[model samples]
Target: MTRYIAYIMCPALLCLYLTGCDFEDEYNVSPRRNFESLWKIIDENYCFFEYKNVNWDNIYSRYSPEIEEQMSDYDLFRIMSDMLDELQDGHVNLLSSNVGISSYDGWLNGYPSNFNTEVLRNTYWSRSQNYNDIVKHNRIVDNQIGYIYYGSFKESILEKDLDNIFSTFSYCKGIIIDVRDNGGGSITNSDRLASRFLNEKTLCGYIRHKTGKGHDDFSDPYPIYLTPSHGYLWLKPVIVITNRKCYSATNNFVSKMKVLPSVTILGGRTGGGSGFPFTSELPNGWSIRFSTSPILDVDKQHTEFGIEPDIEVDLTDEDIKENKDTLIEEAVRILLN
Candidate 1:
């Protein structure tokens, strides 16, 4: 009877010890814990820290003092949002009920307004039939240069649509692909459009992703190639117009297309967002997203800041008042000459 009681008590004591250990292992969902978790997530997974030359440890030391156990949720969110703003990347974002942050101000704020949609529409798109399509192809410059305006990469352009659009512009002198104010969308869409401009398999750029939690722990870069479209490939000269708003996939398009022999990039510098973002949650259930992959230009340099045009041109006030787009005029002149 004594042995049986001892065995039963031993099992009970072991169970209690395991339960206590588990309790200690699980983090309490407090404001401090939430802030710590968010900080660590970016520290481990963010890809641009070294490229951006940011000291992660110093950032932590600076912001950690602001976090307290008794801090309100809104206050914690603000702290985290401000902490992420140090990255200076438009791809980084944090959102909660009380706060929403996207780091676009660093690159776009106070820049020259290079684009006027009212002017573009009144000048060119007004002449296009079915102008509301995802891809609009209009014959401009007195039906000599084919003009294609892509508003966003988010909208998918079908092969059939490309076939028809290209067929419509088959007799033009050259083509102009305008992607101004395009915040980027589907990589596939950009690739789809690029394929139409290539005649052979062309090496455009490279991409890499985080393979480990360390900031610099990324996989070997992979080459991105663009193959000529099987259906309708444009062999004529093409000009791609861009501005500060051309980001993400549009940035990728400019990076790749600039390398082509018959392509010329015009307008202001491109709004660079080469990072492919991924998301995670904090202890408070707020979602935060950041870039974990880096897209490099053909020279294997980061284009996160923006890509310079081959011929840098900005819309001038004098030209705008005369109902003329300086960028458009430049592209047409380049094509015509």
Candidate 2:
């Protein structure tokens, strides 16, 4: 048995000898592979690269050395981040460190979790949340209340100009706003989106970072506000539909809405990814997204843990299949009552 094992080892070592590369060379291959993996994902997934001045060749030369030297996985992620900044598309990006708990463990163990797991999970949650690409305009329900569903925080949705939408909802029994699939987009969009909901302008929430917390006015910038706006639905009871998938700018939307006198969050705990991720593309074609802006609540509590719902409602698999929405039913019932 020992002789047979030695014979097998001898051939394997002989092959390595012929290759003229040792363990160090083999180990280095991993970093390059990682770099390639990221680079390729972007090349395939990004909507457009020409607009971002994507010079694939130059990107590789610029970051290969830095990426190669990254001994720690976290540092390697940083290198990937630095590389992805070259391409400026917000939607085309990477995931977070904490959210990647499963992936990190799987990678280290060599068994590795599937790459699309998070995306798939989030996408499934989003679908379950019943998110639509475009927010339905505000309309009266039974001539008593108004309703609108803004599935995402992307400003593009509001680019159509929301002045009309807000104007329409000015008078109603109450307003029901749904943001279950909002994964978050521009904070500027948050400002404008939130602005449409305000009747009296005042401090909303504070913006914080790894440094600490802050409370800048709406005009201050992303998450830079303490003064609250009466919210367009000030006179109208504002009912926000939330779920575990509510995250980032969406969570910020919820956190701010919580402060409004008229707003009541109904549903589940929000999806916990907060903070604005600064993004860039790598030479290998992978785009990286990292949190650059930290968001805090009125109490200066960061939204990373996600905002809890006031009315805590959930959806069962049956709810999903039967196309039945208990949350919406509850909202309509509350408005009617």
Candidate 3:
């Protein structure tokens, strides 16, 4: 009888030790709470909504049941991503990817370094094999020419690297800023980077657009840039190389520079990707960004379609083999003449 009582008491004590409030609380990371937190954020910060309201009731109705059903976290996030994608704006985009989110811990840190490239190539290479923009860099040929390829405006590191790279072109008789694969970046950076070509301090122009402050009556704010340097400005003929891939802040840069008497844009119509992207996160830990501002040309024309080049040229397979960029080669020919 004594041994039996001891065994029973011991088991009871073990159960009491194991079932504490802290452990139960840690195990109860309520998915519903996470969803509500994100929903409130969207309601308050989103530039616009379906009925001028965030429509949270509908969102909760659509997603809450699934979350309660105990679906995996990834599945829940993808559902939120699809709903946000309906916004159809760049700033409204889902985070770059799952791995990117896990690696950076959040969106405030720089986008991963895998977006664009930096090394100037002595020759041309076919990029049809891969579509990533971050790994592709500015390539140069003939050791005398220069190429600056951009993927987008999201990476701050790339922007810092650009100022240093452009300064090196002070001696080049001509420059080919290959924005062929550039999607866009911070509009301010575009102006800051492009200012290197101007001979003196000048307004990069007010990058502006309307906010639906009230229906058709919109409110606009100007995003402007001014050159910071007095000297070391490359006054040489600047031949901006572009293609369908050149877009957004890049397109904005192209549109503004086209007005300068010293700059010449070369290529086909740029990629139609101009629009200022603003960002927010979705439920289930997915991120989204949408374009709240518009990208306008120097003439204030919107490039929602894209910017057209002054001299259009296409690259052929042979040109890549010879390490000769048809676009840059053409720009040099034109500038030399």
Q: How are the candidates ranked when ordered by TM-score, highest leading? A: 1, 3, 2
**Which candidate leads the pack in lDDT?**
1
Tens-digit lDDT track for model 3 on 50-103? 323456557667776666546567665666565554443334555535523321
Model 2 misplacement above 4 A: 1-133, 138-141, 155-161, 210-223, 226-234, 280-285, 316-323
- Highest TM-score: which candidate? 1
Q: Report lDDT (Cα) of residue 266, candidate 1.
A: 93
User: What is each predicted model's overall lDDT from 0 to 1?
Assistant: 0.87, 0.58, 0.57
What lDDT, from 0 to 1, does candidate 3 have?
0.57
Q: For each candidate, C-alpha RMSD in Å?
A: 4.1, 18.4, 11.9
lDDT of 2 at 185: 68
Off by over 4 Å in 1: 1-29, 131-134
Cα lDDT over the full model 2: 0.58
Q: Model 3, which residues run further than 4 Å from truth?
A: 1-88, 96-171, 200-205, 208-217, 221-225, 282-285
Q: For residues 164-202, could you state the per-residue lDDT of candidate 2 as single tens digits?
A: 555665666677777766667666666666665556655
TM-score between model 1 and native: 0.90
